[model samples]
Each structure stands twice: as C-alpha cells, then as structure tokens.
Target chain A: MKNKIIAFFLGLLILSFAACKKDVAQDQYEVNPVKLYPSIGAKNKNKTQEQYVSILYTNLFQRALSGNQLVEIIDCLESIGDKELGREVLISNFMNDPQVVLPSDSVMRANPDVFTEQTYERFFVRKPSEAEKTWFRNFIEANPQLSAEMIYFAFALSNEYLYY
Target chain B: MNRRKFIRNAGIAGAGAFAVPYILPSGRLFAATGRQLAGHVVYVLFAGGVRQQESILQRYLDDSQGFPWAGNIMYNMFNGPSPENKIVYGTNQGNGVEGGTPIPQILSQTLETQGTVFREVQAQSAGHFGGLNNLLQGSQVTTQGLKQKPINPTIFEYLRRHGGFPASKVWFVGNGIGNGLPLLNYSNHPNYGSQYGANFFAPSITFGNLGFEHLSNAKVYHPENELDPMYQMKYFLDQSFANVGKGGDSLGNTEDEKQDIKSFMRSTYDRVTQNAIPFPTITENNDALNIGFACEIMRWFKPAITVVNLSSVDGCHADFTGYLRALHRADHAVGHLWNYIQTQIPEMAGDTVLIASPECGRNLNHNPIKDVNDWYAYDHSDNNASRVFTVMAGPGVPQNLSIGNEANPVGFTSDNVPTIGEILGVKDEIMGAGFLQPESVSLFDRI
Candidate 1:
C-alpha cells in the first residue's frame, strides 16, 4: 500500500512538473522554419498586429503601402480602427512620415553586426541563426548600398517576426 | 536545482505569449484549375428584403391597401413602365418643392432587354446575413449563427483555389463597414479558407479626406534619420496589434505578390488623389456611394470577380416612403454602375457578367407603423419574406429572357453562386468540391 501511494504521488508530481516547464530550446525554434508558418487564426490564435504584419509585408518588397485591407479583421472591429484614425493618424505615420525612416546603406555598411543582433532580438526575439546571420551578412556585403533600414525592416516586418 | 531555475525561466519567456513566428505558407496549393468562361464578374448582394409586391410584381398597393396603385419604381433592371406619377426618389433641391432630380434616367437599356431574371426566386433565409451567406457561399446553412465565420467556403475561395486566380484579382468593395458585411470576403472552412479570400475595404472610410491626407500620393519613408519616428510608428502598430481581439487566421500573399499589391495600392491611391477616374456624383443616398466605388474598382483592377452590397433600401421597417426613395436610388446606382461597365470600361464591356438579388423579401402583413406618406410600413418575418428575385446579364445570359413568374415559381437564390461558377468557367470544379447547398444549380443550365 505504501509503495502504491508513492507510485501514484510520483506520477502526480511528474505530471505537474512537466506541465510547468517548457523547454527553452523549443523557445527559439528555427529562425527560418522549414515549414510555412500557419496563418493568423488558421491553426490557432497566432498572428502579429498590423505594424509587424504591414512592416514585414513592406520590407519583403521595399516601398509604399497598399490602399486595400488584404489581411484579417477582428470580431469587434470588422474593418479597423475608426477609418478616420486609421487613415489620418496611424497609417499615414507608417507610410508617409519621411521622418519615419529605415536604415541607410552607409550605416548598415558601418555596423552590420549591431544591426543584425538588434533585428533578431526585436523581430525574432532571439539570437540570429548562423544560417540567417551568414546569409544577411553576405547580402549586406554584396549590396553594400542597401540602406540600414532595409535590414532592420526585414527582421522587424519578417514573417518570422509575425510569430502567432 | 537547475530544474527549478529552468521552470522559472520558461515561465518568464512564456508570460508575454511571445515566440518565434512560424514562416507564412505560400504557393498555390490549388491552382485555379477551374475553367474560365467570363473574364470578370460583378455581383451585388442587393440587401434588405424587397417585397415581391413592391419590387418584382410591381404591386404598389393592391394587396396592402386593396387599391391598384402600382408602377415600376425599379426601372433600371426590369423592363416595365416607369413610376411616372410617383417620382419621390430624386432630389428636390432644384425648386425646393420636393421629389425631383435632373439626373438623366439611364436611357441606354434595361437589364431585362439584355439578361435573365427570376421573378419568383426563393430566398432560403429571411434574415439579411443568412440570405447573404446563401448568396455568397451557395448554401442554406440554417444553423449559421450571427456575426461569426461562415462554416462553408465562400465563392471567393472557390475562385482562388479552383480558378487559380491570385488574391489581387478578387475584390469585395463594401459599403460602410458594419453589420459584419466586411467579414464575408472569406469563410472558416479548413480546406477553402482565408488564403483564398477577397480584399475588402469601405471606400468612404479609406477614400475620404483622411485617406486623401494619408494614402493618396503618400511618400515612402527614408528610415535612416527616422529611428525615433520608426519607434513611435512601431509602438502604434504594436498597440493596434494588441487591440485585435480573438483569432481566425487567413492565407497571406507571397512576398513578391504582397509587394506587387503594395505598388498597385500606391498607384490606386495616387489615382484617387488625382481624380483620374470618374467618381459618380452622389448627393443624398448612401447606396449610391457604394455603386460609385464599384465603378472605380472595375476601372482600376478589372478584377476577375467583385461583390458589393447595397443595404440602404433595408429601411422599410419604419419609413415606407423613405424605403421607396432608397430602393429607387439603389436601382439608379445599379443602372449607372452597369452602364459605366458597358459604355466606359472598354475591356470588360462585353466580357463581364453581372448578378443582382435581394437577401429576401419583406413580410406580406403590414406593421403597425405608418410612414409620413401615409403608406403602411411592413416587416420581414412571414413566409412571403422568402420570396425574392434574381437578375443576371452578360455574354452567356439569354437576352430578353424572363423565367419563373409568380405562379410557377422555379428557382432558389442559392443558385446564384453556381450560376456565377458556370459563367466564370469553374462550375464543375466548384461543384466537385461539394460544399455548395445541394439545391444550388446554374441558372444558365435551368434556362
């Protein structure tokens, strides 16, 4: 009877402990995952907000924003922040404000490592994967003329940053 | 000892619910393998229940008031006599005498002369949303609850998956975004979901003064000297993201496609700023604004398929006269938009097909309320509310064709989707997917 009690308690303890600790290794996952990320709300409730989603979208194709709303909407705000606010204060600042800048080519040339680390931490929330670091470094070296904002923007607006 | 430390660390990391985002999936999982018949389709979810008597039957008051005061108030789509003695729908600003506008009537032609219409169509649901669901999804999902993702896939999904059309090619230009109208672009079906969805936006919200200031002719950010501003912008974006409630994911465009869309968006914004396209002049009515934008979309993208909702006429619950005015204006808007597509949009003139239907009809019995015009107000909850009509015109549609009069009722509103599928050349694959309501059939086939 004593042995049985110990076994049962042991099982209970194991279950409790297992539930508490998520592996840190799993936390980082893959920087460039082999499989496509499930879209926001597809597999589960995983999607970045407009800023990250929009930024990720823009960096992929460096330029202006689109006039249309192509992405998903919430149950409450069927369209978005009151359209006037979305248009006037919010979206305008993201796309129009010239002061709202990306990294210039010269700055990126001067400090690629710092820019890279900041990107991984801010966007991916982790250290750069060797593959990602190597590829980006080569990209910068080859296109030394690319702006600093381009690299930062890439990470910030990357689909990776859009972790659901 | 370290196990406790690991647990603590994991808790901290998981606390914010932050984690590395999985890469977004891309590639045409299902190429629009469906056949292509019509180059473009413009569908109008003519919302708010239109009573058979007031609309198709043109029975102005015989049934309601026991008087034969009937005339064709909706003259644009149907081939019937004009509401000559009754012209209350137009603007009275001319002489301040009420009920008149100089806006020339569309003399080009009526829909009956060029298309097929079902006068005694059967609408599955009397409610606006479900009726719209039936129209878009081609189903009669009686259990579909209000303000939720549709269980079945929408026509938008079929167009993308079977037709192999890109997201850029499909659009849902909505009226002011309310009543969950914006949510109809895609559905929650696992197989056919948001990835194959339409781009929806309320033009009034996105194209007014605010839009002019921000989106139209906007400059790209420099990003170099703008770090602080970027931070501020990021903060705003983060807040917007944070405010978003609940979740249901949709498919996203590829990086290149997204950029392509962005460029197109910029060009469209620029065009709006420059007033390059002819935006119809709408003074009093709200539905007219939506129609005008529909014309703008046709001119801009020439989208393979587009759906717009007209809801201003749903005002019949109280204001009978007002409902008539709005209904009349709705017809005028459709007429103007259709005429623009034919006479102005050279590319889509002959190739495009148009479909229009009310969600359902109103109740036969009158409500207690009476309008200022002394006409009785009617609500929609009776068996008669299921009675509605369908109008379709384009290349493949039989001209001067009228099917199923009131006595010999012969069609369902759900058939519109399959009819659209047939017209667009994807009926077989869409039907093969097997989500459409069993009753759904191509009106063209029926004809």
Candidate 2:
C-alpha cells in the first residue's frame, strides 16, 4: 500500500511539472508615431488685407510693420483691381529693397532636404509629405540658377498663402 | 481612294465645318444676334453735376448770377458764342483777373453739329452714386446702396458674358477711388460677377505719386526659365488648396493679357516722367489728367469699351467761379479726347462711338454760399437735378440732329447702357436678361 501511494504522488508531481512549463519567449515593440496634419484642408479662412500685409512684411523682414506704412501699402494694393497682379508687383518691390533677407544659393543646394523642410514650415506652417519634399529637392537640384528669393517669391504669391 | 470618293469626303467635311456650332470662350454656343454699329464705344460720365443754365441751355451767368453775360462756355460740345464781356472761365494769364484767357476750341466742328444731341433728358437719381449706377447698370434699384457694388449687371458684364469680349478689351478709368468709383466695374449679380468684370484703374492713385513709390520697380522675370517654374510651383500649391475651397476671385484676364497690362503700366510710368501723356492744352485739373490717361489706355488696348469718370466740377457746391472754369476745361478735355482718337489711334479712327452725359444736374436756384467772385454757388438735389442732357457722335449716329427741347424731355439716362449694348451687337442679350429698367430702350430706337 505504501509503495502504491508513493507512485501515485510521483505521477501527480510529473503532471504538475508538465503543466507549468515556461511561456514561449515572445517580444513586443511599442509603436507610437508622432501625430501630424494629413492635409491643408483644415485652413479655410481667408486673411484680410491688413493681416496679409502685416504677416508678409514680418516674414520677409523679421520685424513688424508700422501703421502708416501699412496704410500706404494697402493704398498701393487697392489702386490695382487685379489682386494677383497687385501681389506680384508688391512682392517684386519688396525683393528690390536692400534689406530683404535671403540665404545664399550654395547653402540651399548643400542640404536641400533640411532647407526644404524649414521652408515648408516657415511658409505653410506644416511639414511637407515625403512626396512633396522629394519633388522640391529634385526641382532645386535640377535648376542651378534658381535662388532662394525666387522660391520665397513663389511661396508669397501662392494661393495657399492667401488663406490662414 | 478613288477621285470620286475623295471629292465626296471633302464636300462632307466642308459642310460639317460650316453647319456645326462652335462654342465661344464665354461658353455660348452661338454668337451675338444683333448687328454691331461700331467697333468701340467711349462713354463719358461728364463732370459730376452740370447745370442746364450753364451747359446745354447756354444761359451762362444770366440765369445763375443775374448777370448780363449769356453765352456758352462749352463751345466744343455746343454751338454758341462765348461771353464777350466777363471772360472769367479760362486760364489766368497772370493778370489781375483770376481767369481771363479762354482756351481755344480743339475740334474744328462742335459735337452738336457732328452728331445728335438730347437737349433735355431725365436723370433717374438725384444723388451722384445712384445716377452713375443708372448710367452703367441701366437700372435704378431703390435698394442700391452707396459704397457697394451694383445690384444688377453692368454693361461691362453684359458685353463680356454675352458678347464674349475679353477682360482686357473692357476698361473703366476713374478720376480717383473715392465716391465708390472703383465699385462700378462689376456687380454682385450671381449670373454675371467678377469673371466678367472690367479692368478698372483709378489713375490718380495708380499712376500718381503712390504708384511711383510702389509699382514702378517690378522685376522682369524670364518667361521660359524663371516664370515657368514659378507658375508650375504655384499651380501645384493651388491644386492642393483647391481641394477645399477657392482662394480669391479673378477678373478672368489670361496670363498673356496680364503681362501686356504690366508692360503698359511700365510704359505709362516712363511717359509720365517724360511729360509725354496726351494731355489737353489746359491740363491744370484732375479731369484733364484723367482724360489724358484715358487717351493712353485707348492707344494701348484699343479696348471695345472705355468709360471715363470726371468729378472735379463737384467743387461747384462752394465755388461758382471755379465751376465755370472747370466747365470750360471739361469741354477742352472732351475735344482733346475726340481729336486724339481720330488723329492718334489709327485702329479706332472714324470707327469709335463717343457718348457723354452728366450724372445729374445742379439746382436751378443758387445757394447762399458765395465764391471769390461774389457769385452764388449751386448745389444738386431738387427737381432740377433730374434735368440732364446726352450727346452722341460717331459712325451710325445721325448728324446735325437735336431732339428733346427743354420743354419736351425725350429719353432717360439709363438708355445709355442699351445704346452701348446695341453698339456692341449684344442688345438682344441684354434686353432679354430682364434686369434693365422697364422703360430703358436703345437711343437709336428712340430716334
């Protein structure tokens, strides 16, 4: 009887050992991507004349415009009926000013990816998608004569710039 | 292929080419139906507020100031002798008198003899803005407000939307931007809005000191290399944004037209510096300057229609002597404009129609205000303000004919729009729109 009890206890111990075997060595990697805007659809409101002039002056000069100068600029814009042509002329006039700040062409060409990303953020207030970034980088690399001033001009005159 | 089969195919192709309806740029499947009278039309909203006593009536000071001087000061537009005694409505030759030397007439023949004149016409509005609206919109909506666009389509829209005229072919030149002069280029009507608006220029602000300081230094971008790439980038950005909404309304001027306009602005700036604008002999006032710019615009664009607004004579509310001087100068300006078209512009010579009318008339009675000459001033806003006149001259207008004497008024100021439409071969389209004043009709029909 003693021998039978010992054997039965031994079988119970073997069953417990088989049932408690270690869990499989599975690994997990937490994925949390930084959130970004999907598209430009969120910006819907149009900027007023004052807002446009003020923001444009600040963007180019890194300073705020005075009230009297703002009025004069508005007058210049109002004198023209075609708002697009008016903006073109006004931007060219600003570019002609000696104080207009722009980076050198060599700097832009050396690190196109960084320059383009910064430009997109400065003007559009958003990061460019991979496709947009790649397209711009290719465009800049192809055209050696293109200047930062011209790119800035294009951005300032863009239809997207007219809205907030 | 056999010769007989080739001939049959050629005939079929020719027939199809003629029978099939082609669409115009304005999206119309057919061309205008009315017969065009002239290739161009120049409508002048003659000085702000002219008095019948001083203008068409030729009463001069006899009717306004109780003086014995009774003669026409607008000899270029009317046929009458100048006042021999008190010749104060001319340039001051540094004499003790303020105005002593009258400007010589510009036209060999007066407009009254050259074409038909409506001696007395009814003005729909006593106010300046409303009267101007009547002349352009051909409708006097009681709800029309100041400083707002017209409620109905203007002649510019009618010609562009129905007549298929391009934006560069229509223009409105204002003396200044004040008094809502810029708003007259387009209307708020949903059917015909900004896409068909005229290209407007308030030259006093556009080409004056302000323009010189701002617009004279535009950079000339290369068409193939620079501008092409820039425009491509802009288009991409626009497409991205357009997925949501449009940015702003455009006047529908093609890129080529916009470039041409920029070139014109550059040349005008150079001309101003050289004192080469075609100004009248007595170019002392804003009216003369405005007309000079109008002449330049016509010379450049050869537009289908050009409307020039002159308002210097509005000073008459406080100065009668100044009013007379301005009236004489206004006549000189008109004479210069007509003479310029015939002599300077070969394309428009003898083919353009000239129409002129005052927005409203001044009060028959003088106000309490007195000028430096001790003469009483006149203000508008009475029954007399509704009394106005219209003068038409050009190819299809009747010569040496005068209708509607002071006692028998014949036409309304709103008739000018339909008259312009008739001249441009879009009268049927405009009349069918059902937006014009009920009584409005072509002046030719009136004849």
Candidate 3:
C-alpha cells in the first residue's frame, strides 16, 4: 500500500516538472499576438459571416451558437451539402412534407396565381407587395440560373434568415 | 411632513392605498465599484445538487448512505484521501474488473490551500431552473418560470456592460442543451437584454455530429444559390425566436470581433487537426467532455469570463450509484480542467480566477428505489436541498480560508455574483445595478 502511494506521488512529480520547461518573467502578462486567429475571406464575407453562420446553425444544424466557432459551422454545412445526393432524397421528401409542396403542372395551369401566394407566404414569411412581386418575377426571368432548389438553399444560407 | 403623510392626514387618500417602492427592487442598475482584481474569471456552475458532507467535508458514505466510507473522493479541491470502501466511481476499464487509475490530484496545492471556501451556502430553490437563476442572476426569484428569459441580469451582463468587455470576452459554455440551459446566456430585462448577453454555445453539439455534417467542408455557395434560401429560412427562424420569447438575438460583436472569432475558430480547427493543441485524454462522461472543450475555449480566446455547467450527477434522482459515480467523475473532470488552465494555457496560467458551486443539493433522506448495489437514490425537492457549498480559488483570493456553517449560515447562492464582480473589479457596478439581492455581499468584503 505504501509503495502504491509512493508511485502515485512519483507520477505527479514527473507530470508537474514536465509542464515547467518554459521559464517565465514572473509579473508580466503573456498574451498571444494580434491576428492570432486567421480569417480566410475578403471584407464582404467577413462582414456577413456572423449572419450567414447564424442562419445555418439555427436552420440546418438546428442549434444556437455564441458565434465563436465559425470555422466549425462552415465545415459542418459543407459536409451536409457534400452529401447532397443523400440530401437530394431529403429535399424531395421535405418538398412532399406539407411545407414546400408544389402543385402539379396540370393543377398549376388551372390556378397559376395560387403559387404566388404560397411562394411569398412560405419563402418570406409574409405576402409580397405587387411592386415587389413584379420585380421578383422579372428578376427570375432575367436570372435563368436561379432554380427552386437553389432558392431554398439560398434562403437557408441568407443574412435575412438571421436578422431580427 | 411628506406628501403621502399630508394626504393621509387631510383624509384625501387612505394611507394604505399608496404603494411604496423599494430602491433595490427597482430594476434600474447603478455604477460599478471598478476594483478589477483579476483579468479573467472561470465560474464553474458545479451544479446538480452536491451535498456538503459528500463533497467539501469529505464524508463519503458514512453520513449519506450509512456506509463505513468517510474520506474525500474529491482530493483536488479539498484536502484528504478518498474513502475506504467500494469505490466504484473511479474509472473502470476492465469491464468492471479493473478501475481506471485514479487521476493523481492534479494541483500540488488543493483549492482549499490556495483559496477560500464557504462550507455552507443557502440555495434558495430546490428546483433546477430556479436554482440556476438564483446562482447566475444573484437573486432568489420564486416567481421565475422556465422556457422564458431570466427576469434579472446575469453576472455575464454585469461583467460585459461594466467592464467594457465585448460579447466574445464573455461566454457561457453549456455541456448540453438539456433542461432549457441554452436560453440562459441573456435575460428579458429591456435595459440590458441580448445586447449585453454572453456568447453562448454548446460545445458537445458543435464538435459532435453537427460539426461533422455541416461544417466539415464549409463550401461557399454561388450568388444564385445564396439568394434563394434567404427568405425561406427567415420565416423559420422568426417563428423559432418568437416561440422562445427572445425574438431577436444579436450576435453582439463588432465586425472585427466577429471576424477575429471566425479566424480563431478556423485556426483552432487547423491546429487541432495538426495536433498543435493538447487534447486531454477523454472519458465517456459528458462532464469530462465539457471540461475538455471549455479548456479549449480558454486556451484559444482566453475570454475574460467563462462559465461551465456540470449536470450528469443529476442522475441521483433515480440511480444513487450512478449519481455517486457521476459526482466522483465530476471531481475528476474539474481536476483535469484546473491542471490544464494552470499548466497548459500559458495566457491563463497565473492570471485566471476560478469559482464553483452547485445550483442546489439533494435531500438528506434517500428515495425509495435502490440501485443494483442496493444504494438508495435521493431527490432534491426537500427543503434540505438548499444545503450546498461554494469554492473560490485564485491569486486574489485568501488562501485556506473557511467560512459559514449549517448552524450559522453566512452566504446565499446569489452571493457568488457580487463576489466574482468584486474579484474582477466590477463589484460596485454589479451591486450598484440593483437587480441582485441587496444582501449578496462580496467574499472580499466579508474577508
């Protein structure tokens, strides 16, 4: 029993000495230099990084963050998107899941304006004004690259998603 | 002489009809004392009802369970050896055959040898959320409810507002989001709401499956992909916030600070993957994981203030043996954390101050159910649940000082707020704020 106790004390002594290698100037505070953490993007990305990351964590990752761990948040989002194939299945399932369901072509032909209310109500959380609607319809025509899935993904990653 | 008295005398108004308001209860806060004794403070809400006898007093099972054991399982904080009996709480790797080697007491000097202790502290509430509110907000509000914002300002707000510290400098790192723990980083008080709130995040969630799924690549989207999700997710988040009653949670950092945190988190990931940062040997326990990540935050940002919560021991409500094991492990996690702070983190080595106390304590009597080992579990609903202790350790604290007792209690659970405020040079500001209990005196003042 005494030998076991001695071994424990001996171990502690070794651990303690191991950490004391760096001799320090006793009263001075040693802080890491400025820009110690590296940010990768240009000013625009950096400016909106908090809002973007906030939306992703809140909506997709489904949690609240204090906003300190941005790298991990982005890393988390990309990995989800990397599984876009698996998530394509999820997206389609979610489309069928009450919230984002769209009318069939024949059904939509009979009630073309039905989707306008649904789109504004579901996407913006509010109905769009007539001027706003006209601008959006023109904008969609002018930008052929904008797809419905891309639009959903865009809203999921937007600054507007996080702003009060 | 007074207007009210004159009105009563003139029979123009009934004397009891006029409402008298107290100064302290009025939500308006006062200025800070500005005694800033330390650069940083790590307040460990060492929660989930730890009893004094089982903890600081080191009365293992002799008192609570009627066993022959009577020694300290928590050798790092208090001075003593663990009890002599079935010590199953220590890590056991051998399929319950061989116990993991007990972590050697990490601190050469026990917290008691290096700091002051309040042997008896009165936790105002036996319930989890209420006790937590009292501990962080520094006032016992019996009317406070759950799933809503705290009624009074937290120490986080007091420190941030009075000390001119940014949101990143104040952090509340919760172990898990269980028990509605995430909502506590800010309060509902209009004067000092989310803007003065602490930057709070659950590390377990961030570093676990969530991190793996979404953040691994962090691929930036094209302009077209970006604009589409904006409106849709807004509606989702708006409803979510409205449900929680904090309709808007501003990230609360300047653009530079936000960028700094982003870069730091990025740098941290690179260093971590490269093995530049020392990851402590982890255990299966959630408390240990929390301590690990908390140490990471302190090392990376060295936030002026950091708060951690340990609640695994809450298992005591059903399984006493599990509770005992969790308590023992909680001590072990704390020991590793302090050692890391003292030895590994050069920035916080000598500059940091640490304070810890349970949110509340379990009842003195045992519950009806028994574990496989036949040890009975305990509940915290009894008034005896208010019995708890507080520990403070750092250079600024008086070494080896002991205060309070069951017979003549000296402090309330709320006292920790003003006490830490005093240590960090914000005592006057915190007390002057007037939201805390007027009687919650600083430990420095008591000394």
Candidate 4:
C-alpha cells in the first residue's frame, strides 16, 4: 500500500514537471535588407571642375592645391569646350612639372601588381578585382616601353576618374 | 538566266534600293528633307545692346547728344556716309581728341550692298540674355533666367540633330565666357542636349594669359606608343563603367575629332605666341580678338556652321564714347571676318553663308551716366530696345536687297534660326519641331 502511494506521488511530480516546461522560440534576429554596390562602378556622380582639379592636384603632388591655383586651373578648364581634352592637357602640364611625384619605371616594372593597386587606390579610390589586376599586370609586363607616367595618364584620363 | 527571272530580280533590286535609305555619318537614316541652300553658315550674334539710332539709322551725335552730327559709324555693314563733324567713334589719332580718326572700311563692298537687310526687325526681348536666347533658340522663353542654360534647343542642337552635322562641324566662338555666353553653346533640353551641341571656345580666355600659363605646356605624347595604349586602357575602364550608365556629359566628338582639336589647339598656341593670328587691322577690343580666333577656326576646321558672338558694345550702359568706339571696331571686325572667309578659306569662299543680327537695341533716351566727352550713356529696357536689324549674305540670298523700314517693321529677331535652318537644309524639321516663336519664319520667306 505504501509502495502504491509513493508511485502515485512520483507520477504527480513528473506530471507537474512536464506541465511546467515552456516552449523555446527559434532565434531569428530581424534586420532590414541592405543594398550593396559590389564594384568600382558604384561611384556614379561626376566630380565638378573644382573637385576634379583639387583632387588631381592632391593625387599628383601628394599635397593640397592652393585656392588661387585651383581657381586658375578651373578657368583653364572652362576655356576649353571638351572637358576631357582640357583635363588631358592640364594633366600633361602637371606631368611636366618638376614637383609632380611619380614612381620610377623600374619600380613599376618590378611589381606591376603593386603599382596598379596603388594607382587604382589613388585615382579611383577603390580596390581592383583579380581580373583587373591580372589584366594590368600582363599589360605592364608585355609593354616594355610603357612608363609609370603613361599608366598614371591613362588612369587620370579614364572615364572612371571623371566620376566619384 | 531567263528573261522573266532577270526582270523580277531587277525590279526587286530597284525597289530595295529605293526603299533602303542611306545612313549619314551623323547616324541619320537619310539626308535633310529640304534642299540645302548653302554648304556652310557663319552666323554672327551681333550681341550687346546696339542702338538703332547709332547703328542702322546713321544718326551719330545728333540723335543722342543734341550735337548736329549725323553719319554711319558702321560703314562696313551699312551703306551710308561718315559724320562730317564731331567724329568720336574711331581710333584715337593723338589729335588731343579721343576717337578723332575713323577706322577705314575693311570690306570692299558694304554688306548692305551684298545681302538683304531687315532694317526694322522686331526683337523679342529687351534684355541682353533674353535677346541672345531668342537668337539662339529661335524662341523667347519668358521665364528664361540669367546664368542658366538655354531653356530650349539651340540652333546648334537643331542643325546637329536634324541636319546631321557633327559636333566638330558646328562651332560657337564666344567673345568671352561671361554673361552666359558659354552656356549658349548647348541647351538643357532633354531630347537635344550636349550630344548635339556646338564646340565652343571663348578664345580670349582660351589663348589668353591664363590659358598660356596653364594650357601652353601640355606634353605631346607619341600617338602610337603612348596615346594608343592609354586609349586602350581608358576604353577598358570605360567599358567596365558603361554597365553603370554614362557618368558625365559628352560633346560627341570622336577620337579623331578630339585629336584634330588638340592639334589645332597646339597650332593655335604656336600662332598666338608668334603673333600670326589673322587679326583685324583695328584689333583694339575683345570683339576683334574674338574675330581673329574665329577666322583661325574657319581656316582650320572649315566647319559647317560657325557662330561668333560679339558683345563689346555692351559698354553702352556705362560709356557712350566707349560704345561708339566699340561699335566702329565691331564693324571692322565683321568686315575682317568676311574678308578672311573669302580670301583665306578657299573651301568656304563661295559656299559659305554669312548672317549678322543685333540681339537688342538700346533705349531711345539716355541714362544719367555721361562720358568724358559729355555724351550720355543709354541702357536697353524700353520699346526702342525691341527695334533691331538682320543682314544675311550668301548663295540663294538676293543680292543688294533691303527689306522693312522704320515706319513699317517686317521681321522678327528669331527669324535667324529658321533662316539658318533654310540655308542648312533643315527648315522643315525645325518648323515641325514647333519650338519657334509664333511669328518666327525664315528670313527667306519674308523676302
């Protein structure tokens, strides 16, 4: 009789424990969807004349351009109708300046990968993809006569450089 | 091989030939609908407020300053005699009087004798910018603001889009980049914008001291070894960006055209340094300098349409004496430009059409501002400002014909756009576009 009473008590205790158990919800922290731009082309806005000159001067000289110099450059650009041609001439003029900083051809030839990465970073302000890097590497390797200045010129005059 | 087969094939081929239109270089399916009156046109926006009393009227000081002097200062453009006394609209000759010696005529025959002149044409606007817009857009947008791009498609856009003229083929040589002159090269219209815009050059700023300091020192890369690779890389980059859409506006000059323009710029710089520009004999103002560059452009490009803007006479608001001198020099500049086209550019000698018209006329009465000569200055903002003139000379234009008079006005300032359209074989398209002013019609039609 005692054994039967103890079993009944134990059954009740188990029932109580089972009834007290709570359901655990799946862990799913909600977040809003994010739009991402995966390539260098994410930069879509065109740089104004002032912005272009100022940034270009900074890139070449590794320093800021003076206000007066910036205005003069903008004026020179305004004089020409074709903005690309104007920028081309202005860049060439800057290339001719002794103060312009550029990596030596030997340094560029030693590691085109590094040179291209830095160029992309400097002008486009983006990291190049593997394909882009490989293409530039092969181009630099194949063309023995190509100089660092030419590479910079190409980057500076590229359509990508015109935009942000 | 058989007669029936041959006949069928020939008929089919003929039908195909007739049906399939030839594509022009400008990507047009066919040539302009209307007959091309001239191969080239040189339209001069005789801008800046010009007083009809001082210009077409041949009334010098008599009409303005109460002095008993009356004559034509613009002898090159009009058929009239110079003033007998109080001659103060010419180069100074150190005779203790400013503008004592009149500038000699550059044109052997006056433009009035060579072409048709609309003596009392109605200008759409009294303001300078508005008047300029009327001349360029062929319509007057009442809400057009200053320092803004044209509200409608310009003649440059019309000629380029309809006439299929390349960007390089159409040119706008501005006197300076002030007063929205540069903006007039193209319009902000969605359908016809920079793609069909004229290639502009404000030469005073381009080849001036500022340009010399900045643009003169460009490095000339070898076309094959340097420029080719650079272009290849740039094209690759552009291709990558093309997926994202166009990043900036383009004037639609091809690579070859860009190279040609660059070459021209280099040559121009050399010419500027050597003082070899074909300047007018009395190149004492910015207008004359502008004409010199326009001549250079004509000599080099032989563009299909070239519009030169002259605005030195705008000084009339502050200096009447300066206004007279500038007007006189402007006449000389126009004469020099015409002479240069005839004598210097053999390709455009007989085929080119030359048209000149003032934007607006100055006020009838003078302002309080007076010059050292006690001459009163005039501002444009009255009914008198609506009175202007148009003169055109070229093939298909009736020679020595004069239309309209002070008592009976007979044309609109906006007529020049259609007039140019008629000359360039795009009159039907321009009229069909319906952007013109209500009264605007070809000057030829008026004639």
Full-model lDDT for every candidate: 0.69, 0.89, 0.67, 0.89
- lDDT tens per residue, model 2, B147-227: 999999999999999899999999999998888887888899999988999998888888999888878888888877887
Error of 4 at B278 (Å): 0.5
Candidate 3 per-residue lDDT, tens place, A1-164, comes to: 99999999999999999888788778976644523112111112222435555544444433455655655444333222112221222233233334343444444334334444455454334554565455445544555454554445534433333333
* Candidate 4 docking classification: acceptable
Off by over 4 Å in 2: A1-39, B1-20, B94-96
> Candidate 2, residue B277: CA error in Å?
1.0
Cα deviation at A68, candidate 1, in Å, is 21
* Leading candidate by TM-score: 4
The 10-residue segment with the lowest total lDDT in model 3 chain B:
B21-30
What is the C-alpha DockQ of each candidate?
0.06, 0.42, 0.05, 0.42
Supply the global lDDT for candidate 2. 0.89
Higher-ranked by lDDT: 3 or 4: 4
Q: Candidate 4: deviation at residue A113, Å?
A: 1.2
Alpha-carbon TM-score of each model against the true structure: 0.74, 0.89, 0.68, 0.90
Superposed Cα deviation of residue B379, candidate 1 (Å): 3.2
